[model samples]
Target: MVMEIVCPAGTPAALRAAVRAGAHTVYCGFNDETNARNFPGLNFDRSEMREGVDFAHAHGARVLVAINTFPRAGDQSIWHRAIDDAKLSGADAVILADAGLLDYAARTHPGLRLHLSVQAAAANADIINFYAGTFGVKRVVLPRVLSVPEIAAINAETDVETEVFVFGGLCVMAEGRCSLSSYATGLSPNMNGVCSPASHVKYHDNNGELDAKLGGFTIHRAAKDEPAPYPTLCKGCFSAGGQTGHLFEDPVSLNAEQLIPQLQKAGVRALKIEGRQRSKSYVAQVVRNFRAAVDALEAGRPLPEGMLARLSEGQAMTTGAYKKTWR
Candidate 1:
Protein backbone atom coordinates (compact mmCIF):
# COMPACT_ATOMS: atom_id res chain seq x y z
CA MET A 1 0.00 0.00 0.00
CA VAL A 2 1.17 3.54 -0.71
CA MET A 3 2.06 5.38 2.49
CA GLU A 4 -0.35 8.25 3.11
CA ILE A 5 1.17 11.71 2.83
CA VAL A 6 -0.19 13.83 5.67
CA CYS A 7 0.65 17.52 5.33
CA PRO A 8 0.01 20.56 7.51
CA ALA A 9 -2.17 23.46 6.34
CA GLY A 10 -2.07 26.46 8.69
CA THR A 11 -4.28 28.62 6.50
CA PRO A 12 -7.01 28.28 3.86
CA ALA A 13 -4.48 29.06 1.13
CA ALA A 14 -2.09 26.40 2.44
CA LEU A 15 -4.93 23.89 2.51
CA ARG A 16 -5.57 24.37 -1.19
CA ALA A 17 -1.86 24.34 -1.93
CA ALA A 18 -1.33 21.01 -0.15
CA VAL A 19 -4.26 19.36 -1.88
CA ARG A 20 -3.12 20.66 -5.27
CA ALA A 21 0.40 19.50 -4.43
CA GLY A 22 -0.96 15.93 -4.03
CA ALA A 23 -1.33 15.53 -0.27
CA HIS A 24 -3.56 12.58 0.49
CA THR A 25 -4.56 14.17 3.79
CA VAL A 26 -4.11 17.66 5.20
CA TYR A 27 -4.35 18.45 8.92
CA CYS A 28 -5.11 21.85 10.42
CA GLY A 29 -6.45 23.57 13.49
CA PHE A 30 -8.80 26.41 14.35
CA ASN A 31 -7.55 29.87 15.32
CA ASP A 32 -7.66 29.19 19.05
CA GLU A 33 -5.98 27.45 21.96
CA THR A 34 -7.45 24.07 21.13
CA ASN A 35 -4.65 23.26 18.71
CA ALA A 36 -0.90 22.92 19.31
CA ARG A 37 0.28 25.38 16.67
CA ASN A 38 -1.87 28.29 17.86
CA PHE A 39 0.23 31.13 16.58
CA PRO A 40 -1.11 34.67 16.20
CA GLY A 41 -1.75 34.78 12.43
CA LEU A 42 -1.82 31.06 11.63
CA ASN A 43 -4.74 28.58 11.59
CA PHE A 44 -8.26 29.03 10.26
CA ASP A 45 -11.49 30.53 11.49
CA ARG A 46 -14.84 28.71 11.46
CA SER A 47 -15.89 29.75 7.95
CA GLU A 48 -12.41 29.27 6.56
CA MET A 49 -12.25 25.78 8.08
CA ARG A 50 -15.53 24.81 6.48
CA GLU A 51 -14.37 26.10 3.13
CA GLY A 52 -10.96 24.45 3.50
CA VAL A 53 -12.50 21.10 4.28
CA ASP A 54 -14.85 21.49 1.35
CA PHE A 55 -11.96 22.31 -0.93
CA ALA A 56 -9.90 19.31 0.20
CA HIS A 57 -12.81 16.93 -0.26
CA ALA A 58 -13.62 18.41 -3.66
CA HIS A 59 -10.05 17.63 -4.69
CA GLY A 60 -10.27 14.03 -3.38
CA ALA A 61 -8.22 14.78 -0.27
CA ARG A 62 -9.12 14.49 3.40
CA VAL A 63 -8.92 17.08 6.20
CA LEU A 64 -8.19 16.23 9.84
CA VAL A 65 -8.93 18.87 12.45
CA ALA A 66 -6.36 19.07 15.24
CA ILE A 67 -8.01 19.65 18.62
CA ASN A 68 -4.88 18.35 20.32
CA THR A 69 -4.25 20.70 23.25
CA PHE A 70 -5.08 19.76 26.82
CA PRO A 71 -8.12 21.55 28.17
CA ARG A 72 -7.94 23.84 31.18
CA ALA A 73 -9.88 23.07 34.34
CA GLY A 74 -13.41 24.56 34.41
CA ASP A 75 -13.00 25.73 30.83
CA GLN A 76 -13.55 22.57 28.78
CA SER A 77 -16.47 24.23 27.02
CA ILE A 78 -13.99 25.79 24.63
CA TRP A 79 -12.48 22.43 23.78
CA HIS A 80 -15.90 20.81 23.46
CA ARG A 81 -17.01 23.55 21.14
CA ALA A 82 -13.93 22.93 19.04
CA ILE A 83 -14.89 19.28 18.63
CA ASP A 84 -18.42 20.18 17.70
CA ASP A 85 -17.22 22.77 15.24
CA ALA A 86 -14.77 20.33 13.70
CA LYS A 87 -17.53 17.82 13.07
CA LEU A 88 -19.78 20.57 11.74
CA SER A 89 -16.94 21.73 9.50
CA GLY A 90 -16.87 18.43 7.61
CA ALA A 91 -13.57 17.17 8.97
CA ASP A 92 -12.58 13.63 8.10
CA ALA A 93 -11.17 13.10 11.61
CA VAL A 94 -10.37 14.97 14.81
CA ILE A 95 -6.95 14.46 16.40
CA LEU A 96 -7.10 14.55 20.18
CA ALA A 97 -4.64 14.29 23.09
CA ASP A 98 -6.41 14.73 26.44
CA ALA A 99 -8.22 11.70 27.80
CA GLY A 100 -11.22 13.76 28.92
CA LEU A 101 -11.55 15.36 25.52
CA LEU A 102 -11.16 11.95 23.89
CA ASP A 103 -13.87 10.54 26.11
CA TYR A 104 -16.13 13.47 25.33
CA ALA A 105 -15.49 13.07 21.60
CA ALA A 106 -16.05 9.34 21.74
CA ARG A 107 -19.32 9.70 23.65
CA THR A 108 -20.71 12.90 22.15
CA HIS A 109 -19.72 12.42 18.54
CA PRO A 110 -20.03 8.69 18.12
CA GLY A 111 -19.80 8.84 14.35
CA LEU A 112 -16.82 11.16 14.16
CA ARG A 113 -13.41 9.64 13.45
CA LEU A 114 -10.75 10.15 16.15
CA HIS A 115 -6.97 10.14 15.80
CA LEU A 116 -4.69 9.94 18.86
CA SER A 117 -2.31 12.89 18.74
CA VAL A 118 1.42 12.61 19.45
CA GLN A 119 0.86 14.92 22.41
CA ALA A 120 -0.81 12.02 24.17
CA ALA A 121 2.56 10.25 24.11
CA ALA A 122 0.98 6.89 23.34
CA ALA A 123 4.37 5.36 22.76
CA ASN A 124 3.87 1.70 23.63
CA ALA A 125 1.56 -0.99 22.33
CA ASP A 126 -0.49 -1.31 25.52
CA ILE A 127 -1.42 2.40 25.62
CA ILE A 128 -2.10 2.47 21.92
CA ASN A 129 -4.39 -0.51 22.34
CA PHE A 130 -6.03 1.16 25.32
CA TYR A 131 -6.80 4.29 23.34
CA ALA A 132 -8.14 2.17 20.50
CA GLY A 133 -10.29 -0.06 22.67
CA THR A 134 -11.61 2.74 24.83
CA PHE A 135 -12.03 5.68 22.45
CA GLY A 136 -12.28 3.81 19.14
CA VAL A 137 -9.34 5.81 17.84
CA LYS A 138 -8.65 4.72 14.27
CA ARG A 139 -5.13 6.12 14.10
CA VAL A 140 -2.36 7.18 16.51
CA VAL A 141 0.34 9.71 15.75
CA LEU A 142 3.35 8.14 17.46
CA PRO A 143 5.63 10.40 19.44
CA ARG A 144 9.08 11.11 17.97
CA VAL A 145 10.87 9.27 20.78
CA LEU A 146 10.47 5.75 19.42
CA SER A 147 12.94 3.86 17.27
CA VAL A 148 11.94 1.98 14.12
CA PRO A 149 12.27 -1.30 15.96
CA GLU A 150 10.14 0.02 18.81
CA ILE A 151 7.51 1.16 16.34
CA ALA A 152 7.51 -2.21 14.61
CA ALA A 153 7.09 -3.91 17.96
CA ILE A 154 4.08 -1.72 18.76
CA ASN A 155 2.64 -2.39 15.31
CA ALA A 156 3.01 -6.11 15.94
CA GLU A 157 0.77 -5.83 18.99
CA THR A 158 -1.85 -3.29 17.99
CA ASP A 159 -4.24 -2.89 15.07
CA VAL A 160 -4.49 0.90 15.34
CA GLU A 161 -2.95 2.69 12.36
CA THR A 162 0.35 4.43 13.08
CA GLU A 163 1.50 7.83 11.82
CA VAL A 164 5.04 9.18 12.19
CA PHE A 165 6.55 12.60 11.71
CA VAL A 166 8.77 12.43 8.64
CA PHE A 167 9.82 16.02 8.47
CA GLY A 168 9.95 19.37 10.35
CA GLY A 169 10.49 20.46 13.98
CA LEU A 170 12.03 17.93 16.37
CA CYS A 171 10.93 17.99 20.00
CA VAL A 172 13.48 16.81 22.52
CA MET A 173 11.03 16.05 25.30
CA ALA A 174 8.06 13.73 25.17
CA GLU A 175 5.15 15.49 23.55
CA GLY A 176 2.57 17.14 25.83
CA ARG A 177 4.89 17.15 28.85
CA CYS A 178 7.41 19.94 28.51
CA SER A 179 7.42 22.64 31.21
CA LEU A 180 10.39 24.72 30.12
CA SER A 181 8.31 27.09 28.06
CA SER A 182 5.81 27.41 30.86
CA TYR A 183 8.58 28.09 33.34
CA ALA A 184 9.83 30.90 31.16
CA THR A 185 6.61 32.40 29.79
CA GLY A 186 3.92 31.15 32.23
CA LEU A 187 2.19 29.53 29.27
CA SER A 188 2.03 25.82 28.58
CA PRO A 189 2.37 24.52 25.04
CA ASN A 190 0.08 21.57 25.73
CA MET A 191 -2.56 23.74 27.33
CA ASN A 192 -2.12 27.30 26.00
CA GLY A 193 -0.75 26.11 22.60
CA VAL A 194 2.00 28.70 22.53
CA CYS A 195 5.65 27.90 23.22
CA SER A 196 8.15 30.70 23.38
CA PRO A 197 5.38 32.90 22.12
CA ALA A 198 6.47 35.84 20.02
CA SER A 199 5.01 38.25 22.56
CA HIS A 200 7.77 37.36 25.01
CA VAL A 201 10.62 36.98 22.58
CA LYS A 202 13.14 39.80 22.26
CA TYR A 203 16.49 40.32 20.56
CA HIS A 204 19.43 42.43 21.71
CA ASP A 205 22.38 43.76 19.76
CA ASN A 206 25.48 43.72 21.90
CA ASN A 207 28.57 45.05 20.11
CA GLY A 208 27.92 43.39 16.75
CA GLU A 209 26.60 40.19 18.38
CA LEU A 210 22.92 39.31 18.54
CA ASP A 211 21.28 37.64 21.54
CA ALA A 212 17.92 35.92 21.18
CA LYS A 213 15.93 35.72 24.38
CA LEU A 214 12.67 33.96 25.23
CA GLY A 215 10.71 35.37 28.13
CA GLY A 216 13.76 37.43 29.15
CA PHE A 217 16.10 34.41 29.32
CA THR A 218 18.87 34.43 26.75
CA ILE A 219 18.69 31.26 24.68
CA HIS A 220 21.02 31.82 21.79
CA ARG A 221 23.69 34.28 20.67
CA ALA A 222 25.62 34.73 17.45
CA ALA A 223 27.55 37.25 15.43
CA LYS A 224 25.45 39.79 13.52
CA ASP A 225 26.19 38.12 10.18
CA GLU A 226 25.32 34.60 11.36
CA PRO A 227 21.87 33.09 11.60
CA ALA A 228 20.38 32.78 15.09
CA PRO A 229 17.87 30.05 15.75
CA TYR A 230 14.50 30.77 17.30
CA PRO A 231 14.77 30.51 21.09
CA THR A 232 12.63 27.47 21.67
CA LEU A 233 13.42 26.17 25.17
CA CYS A 234 14.64 22.70 24.33
CA LYS A 235 16.68 23.75 21.32
CA GLY A 236 18.20 26.68 23.15
CA CYS A 237 21.88 27.18 23.84
CA PHE A 238 22.68 26.90 27.52
CA SER A 239 25.51 26.45 29.99
CA ALA A 240 25.80 23.17 31.82
CA GLY A 241 28.30 21.84 34.37
CA GLY A 242 31.23 23.18 32.43
CA GLN A 243 30.26 23.94 28.88
CA THR A 244 27.92 26.29 27.03
CA GLY A 245 26.10 24.97 23.97
CA HIS A 246 22.84 23.35 22.93
CA LEU A 247 22.57 21.43 26.20
CA PHE A 248 19.33 19.61 25.42
CA GLU A 249 19.06 19.40 21.65
CA ASP A 250 20.50 21.10 18.59
CA PRO A 251 18.32 23.18 16.31
CA VAL A 252 17.91 20.40 13.77
CA SER A 253 14.69 19.29 12.13
CA LEU A 254 13.66 15.71 11.49
CA ASN A 255 14.14 14.41 7.91
CA ALA A 256 13.24 10.76 7.56
CA GLU A 257 12.81 10.75 3.78
CA GLN A 258 15.48 8.05 3.49
CA LEU A 259 13.57 5.85 5.95
CA ILE A 260 10.30 5.64 4.05
CA PRO A 261 10.72 1.96 3.19
CA GLN A 262 11.88 1.17 6.71
CA LEU A 263 8.93 2.99 8.27
CA GLN A 264 6.56 1.20 5.88
CA LYS A 265 8.14 -2.07 6.92
CA ALA A 266 7.51 -1.00 10.50
CA GLY A 267 3.80 -0.82 9.62
CA VAL A 268 3.47 2.95 9.69
CA ARG A 269 0.42 3.91 7.64
CA ALA A 270 1.02 7.64 7.31
CA LEU A 271 3.95 10.06 7.05
CA LYS A 272 3.30 13.50 8.59
CA ILE A 273 5.07 16.77 7.88
CA GLU A 274 5.27 19.30 10.71
CA GLY A 275 5.29 23.10 10.27
CA ARG A 276 1.81 24.54 10.20
CA GLN A 277 3.44 27.94 10.78
CA ARG A 278 5.19 27.70 7.41
CA SER A 279 4.20 29.55 4.26
CA LYS A 280 1.80 28.13 1.68
CA SER A 281 4.58 27.80 -0.88
CA TYR A 282 6.67 25.81 1.61
CA VAL A 283 3.74 23.57 2.37
CA ALA A 284 3.15 22.99 -1.35
CA GLN A 285 6.78 22.16 -2.01
CA VAL A 286 6.98 19.72 0.91
CA VAL A 287 3.70 18.05 0.02
CA ARG A 288 4.76 17.69 -3.59
CA ASN A 289 8.12 16.15 -2.72
CA PHE A 290 6.67 13.74 -0.16
CA ARG A 291 3.78 12.79 -2.43
CA ALA A 292 6.18 12.03 -5.26
CA ALA A 293 8.41 9.99 -2.95
CA VAL A 294 5.51 7.88 -1.75
CA ASP A 295 4.27 7.39 -5.31
CA ALA A 296 7.76 6.26 -6.33
CA LEU A 297 7.89 3.80 -3.46
CA GLU A 298 4.52 2.34 -4.46
CA ALA A 299 5.84 1.88 -7.99
CA GLY A 300 9.06 0.22 -6.70
CA ARG A 301 11.26 3.07 -7.97
CA PRO A 302 14.24 4.75 -6.36
CA LEU A 303 13.33 7.44 -3.82
CA PRO A 304 14.30 10.98 -4.71
CA GLU A 305 17.57 12.32 -3.30
CA GLY A 306 18.37 15.64 -1.64
CA MET A 307 14.95 17.05 -2.47
CA LEU A 308 14.34 18.82 0.89
CA ALA A 309 17.68 19.47 2.50
CA ARG A 310 17.41 23.16 1.86
CA LEU A 311 14.05 23.23 3.59
CA SER A 312 15.31 21.79 6.85
CA GLU A 313 15.54 23.89 10.03
CA GLY A 314 18.84 25.75 10.29
CA GLN A 315 19.69 23.94 7.02
CA ALA A 316 20.47 20.83 9.11
CA MET A 317 18.49 17.65 9.62
CA THR A 318 18.56 14.42 11.56
CA THR A 319 16.73 11.11 11.71
CA GLY A 320 15.99 11.94 15.39
CA ALA A 321 15.35 8.85 17.55
CA TYR A 322 14.73 6.70 14.48
CA LYS A 323 18.38 5.64 14.39
CA LYS A 324 18.78 5.38 18.21
CA THR A 325 22.02 7.39 17.91
CA TRP A 326 21.46 9.32 21.12
CA ARG A 327 21.88 6.15 23.12
Candidate 2:
Protein backbone atom coordinates (compact mmCIF):
# COMPACT_ATOMS: atom_id res chain seq x y z
CA MET A 1 0.00 0.00 0.00
CA VAL A 2 1.11 3.57 -0.59
CA MET A 3 2.15 5.38 2.56
CA GLU A 4 -0.71 7.49 3.88
CA ILE A 5 -0.22 11.24 4.21
CA VAL A 6 -1.54 12.37 7.59
CA CYS A 7 -1.82 16.14 7.91
CA PRO A 8 -2.52 18.35 10.92
CA ALA A 9 -5.55 20.59 11.09
CA GLY A 10 -5.55 23.30 13.74
CA THR A 11 -8.90 24.73 12.69
CA PRO A 12 -11.91 24.00 10.51
CA ALA A 13 -10.35 25.96 7.69
CA ALA A 14 -7.08 24.08 7.94
CA LEU A 15 -8.95 20.79 7.97
CA ARG A 16 -10.66 21.71 4.71
CA ALA A 17 -7.43 22.94 3.25
CA ALA A 18 -5.58 19.74 4.11
CA VAL A 19 -8.28 17.50 2.71
CA ARG A 20 -8.60 19.58 -0.44
CA ALA A 21 -4.83 19.58 -0.84
CA GLY A 22 -4.91 15.74 -1.13
CA ALA A 23 -4.23 14.63 2.39
CA HIS A 24 -5.33 11.02 2.81
CA THR A 25 -6.04 11.74 6.47
CA VAL A 26 -6.32 14.85 8.63
CA TYR A 27 -5.88 14.89 12.41
CA CYS A 28 -7.10 17.60 14.78
CA GLY A 29 -8.16 18.26 18.33
CA PHE A 30 -11.03 19.84 20.19
CA ASN A 31 -10.83 23.49 21.24
CA ASP A 32 -10.45 22.56 24.90
CA GLU A 33 -7.45 21.06 26.71
CA THR A 34 -8.50 17.58 25.66
CA ASN A 35 -5.96 17.75 22.80
CA ALA A 36 -2.26 18.62 22.87
CA ARG A 37 -2.43 21.72 20.65
CA ASN A 38 -4.79 23.57 22.99
CA PHE A 39 -3.44 26.97 22.19
CA PRO A 40 -5.89 29.87 22.08
CA GLY A 41 -7.76 30.28 18.72
CA LEU A 42 -6.81 26.81 17.48
CA ASN A 43 -8.70 23.47 17.38
CA PHE A 44 -12.32 22.77 16.68
CA ASP A 45 -15.57 23.30 18.56
CA ARG A 46 -17.99 20.34 18.78
CA SER A 47 -20.02 21.56 15.82
CA GLU A 48 -16.93 22.51 13.85
CA MET A 49 -15.42 19.08 14.47
CA ARG A 50 -18.54 17.36 13.18
CA GLU A 51 -18.56 19.61 10.14
CA GLY A 52 -14.85 19.10 9.54
CA VAL A 53 -15.16 15.33 9.74
CA ASP A 54 -18.17 15.43 7.51
CA PHE A 55 -16.30 17.52 5.01
CA ALA A 56 -13.27 15.25 5.02
CA HIS A 57 -15.41 12.14 4.64
CA ALA A 58 -17.23 13.77 1.76
CA HIS A 59 -13.87 14.31 0.10
CA GLY A 60 -12.84 10.67 0.62
CA ALA A 61 -10.43 11.60 3.40
CA ARG A 62 -10.39 10.35 6.97
CA VAL A 63 -10.44 12.53 10.08
CA LEU A 64 -8.77 11.51 13.34
CA VAL A 65 -9.63 13.34 16.55
CA ALA A 66 -6.65 13.78 18.89
CA ILE A 67 -7.65 13.67 22.55
CA ASN A 68 -4.02 13.01 23.35
CA THR A 69 -3.55 14.86 26.66
CA PHE A 70 -3.50 13.24 30.09
CA PRO A 71 -6.59 13.94 32.11
CA ARG A 72 -6.23 15.39 35.58
CA ALA A 73 -7.56 13.59 38.63
CA GLY A 74 -11.29 14.21 39.23
CA ASP A 75 -11.50 15.75 35.75
CA GLN A 76 -11.70 12.66 33.60
CA SER A 77 -15.10 13.65 32.33
CA ILE A 78 -13.65 16.15 29.86
CA TRP A 79 -11.44 13.57 28.21
CA HIS A 80 -14.20 10.97 28.30
CA ARG A 81 -16.56 13.41 26.64
CA ALA A 82 -13.95 14.15 23.98
CA ILE A 83 -13.74 10.47 23.08
CA ASP A 84 -17.51 10.13 22.99
CA ASP A 85 -17.84 13.30 20.92
CA ALA A 86 -15.16 12.14 18.50
CA LYS A 87 -17.13 9.01 17.82
CA LEU A 88 -20.27 11.09 17.38
CA SER A 89 -18.39 13.37 15.00
CA GLY A 90 -17.61 10.39 12.74
CA ALA A 91 -13.90 10.38 13.48
CA ASP A 92 -12.06 7.44 11.92
CA ALA A 93 -10.03 7.11 15.10
CA VAL A 94 -9.07 8.93 18.30
CA ILE A 95 -5.37 9.26 19.14
CA LEU A 96 -4.76 8.75 22.88
CA ALA A 97 -1.65 9.02 25.05
CA ASP A 98 -2.63 8.35 28.67
CA ALA A 99 -3.05 4.66 29.50
CA GLY A 100 -6.00 5.40 31.77
CA LEU A 101 -7.63 7.31 28.95
CA LEU A 102 -6.78 4.50 26.54
CA ASP A 103 -8.36 1.96 28.87
CA TYR A 104 -11.34 4.24 29.36
CA ALA A 105 -11.72 4.64 25.61
CA ALA A 106 -11.28 0.93 24.93
CA ARG A 107 -13.83 -0.03 27.58
CA THR A 108 -16.31 2.77 26.98
CA HIS A 109 -16.14 3.13 23.21
CA PRO A 110 -15.41 -0.35 22.00
CA GLY A 111 -16.46 0.48 18.45
CA LEU A 112 -14.21 3.49 18.14
CA ARG A 113 -10.83 2.95 16.49
CA LEU A 114 -7.92 3.77 18.81
CA HIS A 115 -4.40 4.98 17.96
CA LEU A 116 -1.61 5.32 20.48
CA SER A 117 -0.17 8.80 20.36
CA VAL A 118 3.60 9.43 20.19
CA GLN A 119 3.16 10.90 23.68
CA ALA A 120 2.99 7.33 25.00
CA ALA A 121 6.61 6.93 23.86
CA ALA A 122 6.07 3.35 22.73
CA ALA A 123 9.51 3.06 21.17
CA ASN A 124 9.95 -0.69 21.32
CA ALA A 125 8.08 -3.62 19.82
CA ASP A 126 7.17 -5.17 23.17
CA ILE A 127 5.31 -2.08 24.39
CA ILE A 128 3.72 -1.56 21.00
CA ASN A 129 2.40 -5.12 21.02
CA PHE A 130 1.24 -4.69 24.61
CA TYR A 131 -0.77 -1.60 23.70
CA ALA A 132 -2.21 -3.42 20.69
CA GLY A 133 -3.20 -6.48 22.73
CA THR A 134 -4.38 -4.60 25.81
CA PHE A 135 -6.12 -1.54 24.40
CA GLY A 136 -6.96 -2.64 20.85
CA VAL A 137 -4.80 0.16 19.49
CA LYS A 138 -4.80 -0.29 15.71
CA ARG A 139 -1.96 2.15 15.17
CA VAL A 140 0.96 3.62 17.16
CA VAL A 141 2.64 6.90 16.34
CA LEU A 142 6.25 6.02 17.06
CA PRO A 143 8.28 8.51 19.08
CA ARG A 144 10.77 10.69 17.20
CA VAL A 145 13.72 9.11 18.99
CA LEU A 146 13.91 6.02 16.79
CA SER A 147 16.23 5.44 13.85
CA VAL A 148 14.99 3.79 10.65
CA PRO A 149 16.69 0.52 11.58
CA GLU A 150 15.05 0.57 15.00
CA ILE A 151 11.70 1.32 13.40
CA ALA A 152 12.14 -1.57 10.98
CA ALA A 153 13.00 -3.88 13.88
CA ILE A 154 9.92 -2.81 15.78
CA ASN A 155 7.75 -3.25 12.72
CA ALA A 156 9.19 -6.71 12.20
CA GLU A 157 7.96 -7.64 15.66
CA THR A 158 4.53 -5.99 15.86
CA ASP A 159 1.29 -6.34 13.90
CA VAL A 160 -0.05 -2.91 14.76
CA GLU A 161 0.37 -0.18 12.14
CA THR A 162 3.10 2.42 12.66
CA GLU A 163 2.95 6.15 11.96
CA VAL A 164 6.01 8.41 11.88
CA PHE A 165 6.35 12.17 11.82
CA VAL A 166 8.00 13.30 8.57
CA PHE A 167 7.75 17.07 8.88
CA GLY A 168 7.46 20.05 11.29
CA GLY A 169 8.43 20.75 14.93
CA LEU A 170 11.19 18.71 16.51
CA CYS A 171 10.73 17.82 20.19
CA VAL A 172 14.15 17.09 21.71
CA MET A 173 12.81 15.31 24.77
CA ALA A 174 10.51 12.37 25.10
CA GLU A 175 7.02 13.21 24.06
CA GLY A 176 4.43 13.94 26.80
CA ARG A 177 7.04 13.86 29.57
CA CYS A 178 9.09 17.03 29.17
CA SER A 179 8.93 19.10 32.37
CA LEU A 180 11.18 21.93 31.26
CA SER A 181 8.19 23.93 30.09
CA SER A 182 6.24 23.17 33.25
CA TYR A 183 9.24 24.03 35.42
CA ALA A 184 9.46 27.36 33.67
CA THR A 185 5.73 28.14 33.45
CA GLY A 186 4.10 25.91 36.12
CA LEU A 187 1.77 24.54 33.41
CA SER A 188 2.33 21.00 32.24
CA PRO A 189 2.31 20.53 28.48
CA ASN A 190 1.05 16.98 29.04
CA MET A 191 -1.82 18.16 31.21
CA ASN A 192 -2.41 21.74 30.04
CA GLY A 193 -1.81 21.01 26.31
CA VAL A 194 0.62 23.86 25.76
CA CYS A 195 4.37 24.38 26.05
CA SER A 196 5.70 27.88 26.66
CA PRO A 197 2.18 29.14 26.14
CA ALA A 198 1.89 32.59 24.62
CA SER A 199 0.32 34.00 27.76
CA HIS A 200 3.59 33.49 29.64
CA VAL A 201 5.80 34.65 26.75
CA LYS A 202 7.00 38.22 26.68
CA TYR A 203 9.31 40.10 24.29
CA HIS A 204 11.37 43.05 25.49
CA ASP A 205 13.30 45.58 23.45
CA ASN A 206 16.74 45.70 24.98
CA ASN A 207 19.09 48.33 23.52
CA GLY A 208 18.32 47.74 19.83
CA GLU A 209 17.96 44.00 20.44
CA LEU A 210 14.94 41.82 21.22
CA ASP A 211 14.91 39.42 24.14
CA ALA A 212 12.33 36.65 24.14
CA LYS A 213 11.32 35.67 27.66
CA LEU A 214 9.26 32.81 28.90
CA GLY A 215 8.05 33.06 32.48
CA GLY A 216 10.64 35.74 33.27
CA PHE A 217 13.52 33.62 31.96
CA THR A 218 15.31 34.97 28.91
CA ILE A 219 15.21 32.23 26.27
CA HIS A 220 16.60 34.00 23.23
CA ARG A 221 17.92 37.42 22.32
CA ALA A 222 18.25 38.71 18.75
CA ALA A 223 19.94 41.73 17.24
CA LYS A 224 17.79 44.48 15.72
CA ASP A 225 17.75 42.96 12.22
CA GLU A 226 17.48 39.32 13.31
CA PRO A 227 14.33 37.31 13.91
CA ALA A 228 13.52 36.20 17.44
CA PRO A 229 12.40 32.60 17.76
CA TYR A 230 9.52 31.74 20.08
CA PRO A 231 10.74 30.86 23.58
CA THR A 232 10.10 27.14 23.54
CA LEU A 233 12.39 25.97 26.33
CA CYS A 234 14.03 23.10 24.48
CA LYS A 235 14.75 25.11 21.33
CA GLY A 236 15.87 28.23 23.16
CA CYS A 237 19.38 29.64 23.27
CA PHE A 238 20.96 29.48 26.71
CA SER A 239 24.23 30.47 28.37
CA ALA A 240 25.54 27.40 30.13
CA GLY A 241 29.11 26.49 31.10
CA GLY A 242 30.22 29.86 29.69
CA GLN A 243 28.94 28.93 26.23
CA THR A 244 25.95 30.71 24.70
CA GLY A 245 24.05 28.54 22.24
CA HIS A 246 21.09 26.21 21.77
CA LEU A 247 22.21 23.86 24.54
CA PHE A 248 19.26 21.46 24.34
CA GLU A 249 18.12 21.78 20.71
CA ASP A 250 18.27 24.32 17.96
CA PRO A 251 15.11 25.84 16.43
CA VAL A 252 14.94 23.63 13.35
CA SER A 253 12.00 21.76 11.86
CA LEU A 254 12.20 18.12 10.79
CA ASN A 255 12.01 17.45 7.06
CA ALA A 256 12.21 13.77 6.14
CA GLU A 257 10.94 14.24 2.62
CA GLN A 258 14.24 12.88 1.29
CA LEU A 259 13.75 9.65 3.25
CA ILE A 260 10.27 8.75 2.10
CA PRO A 261 11.46 5.65 0.26
CA GLN A 262 13.56 4.50 3.20
CA LEU A 263 10.67 4.94 5.61
CA GLN A 264 8.33 3.03 3.29
CA LYS A 265 10.88 0.25 3.21
CA ALA A 266 11.03 0.42 7.01
CA GLY A 267 7.33 -0.54 7.13
CA VAL A 268 5.90 2.77 8.25
CA ARG A 269 2.19 2.84 7.50
CA ALA A 270 1.68 6.61 7.51
CA LEU A 271 3.67 9.84 7.22
CA LYS A 272 2.52 12.51 9.68
CA ILE A 273 3.00 16.28 9.43
CA GLU A 274 3.17 17.95 12.83
CA GLY A 275 1.82 21.48 12.79
CA ARG A 276 -1.60 21.80 14.34
CA GLN A 277 -1.03 25.43 15.31
CA ARG A 278 -0.08 26.60 11.80
CA SER A 279 -2.12 28.53 9.28
CA LYS A 280 -4.47 26.95 6.72
CA SER A 281 -2.31 28.14 3.85
CA TYR A 282 0.67 26.46 5.43
CA VAL A 283 -1.27 23.25 5.88
CA ALA A 284 -2.46 23.31 2.27
CA GLN A 285 0.98 23.96 0.82
CA VAL A 286 2.57 21.21 2.90
CA VAL A 287 -0.17 18.75 2.11
CA ARG A 288 0.07 19.42 -1.62
CA ASN A 289 3.84 19.02 -1.64
CA PHE A 290 3.79 15.83 0.43
CA ARG A 291 0.92 14.42 -1.57
CA ALA A 292 2.90 14.95 -4.75
CA ALA A 293 6.02 13.38 -3.28
CA VAL A 294 4.20 10.29 -2.04
CA ASP A 295 2.37 9.93 -5.30
CA ALA A 296 5.67 10.09 -7.17
CA LEU A 297 7.20 7.56 -4.82
CA GLU A 298 4.32 5.16 -5.36
CA ALA A 299 4.78 5.61 -9.11
CA GLY A 300 8.46 4.71 -8.82
CA ARG A 301 9.46 8.25 -9.78
CA PRO A 302 12.36 10.09 -8.12
CA LEU A 303 11.33 12.21 -5.13
CA PRO A 304 11.27 15.97 -5.57
CA GLU A 305 14.31 17.91 -4.37
CA GLY A 306 14.17 20.92 -2.07
CA MET A 307 10.40 21.17 -2.38
CA LEU A 308 9.96 22.28 1.24
CA ALA A 309 13.17 24.15 2.01
CA ARG A 310 11.35 27.47 1.87
CA LEU A 311 8.83 26.26 4.44
CA SER A 312 11.27 24.92 7.01
CA GLU A 313 11.70 26.66 10.35
CA GLY A 314 14.35 29.39 10.14
CA GLN A 315 15.10 28.02 6.64
CA ALA A 316 16.91 25.18 8.37
CA MET A 317 15.81 21.53 8.53
CA THR A 318 17.09 18.33 10.01
CA THR A 319 16.44 14.66 9.32
CA GLY A 320 16.19 14.18 13.11
CA ALA A 321 17.12 10.82 14.68
CA TYR A 322 16.17 8.89 11.59
CA LYS A 323 19.82 8.74 10.53
CA LYS A 324 21.16 8.52 14.11
CA THR A 325 23.41 11.54 13.49
CA TRP A 326 23.50 12.42 17.18
CA ARG A 327 25.63 9.37 17.87
TM-score of each: 0.97, 0.98
Candidate 2 residues 7-64, lDDT tens each? 9999999999999999999999999989889898999999999999999999999999
TM-score of predicted model 1?
0.97
Model 1, 270: alpha-carbon shift in Å?
0.2
- lDDT of all the models against the reference? 0.93, 0.92
146 Cα displacement, candidate 2 (Å):
0.4
Model 1 scores worst on lDDT over the 10 consecutive residues at 222-231
The collision pairs in model 2 are: none
**Residue ranges of candidate 1 with Cα displaced over 4 Å:** 205-208
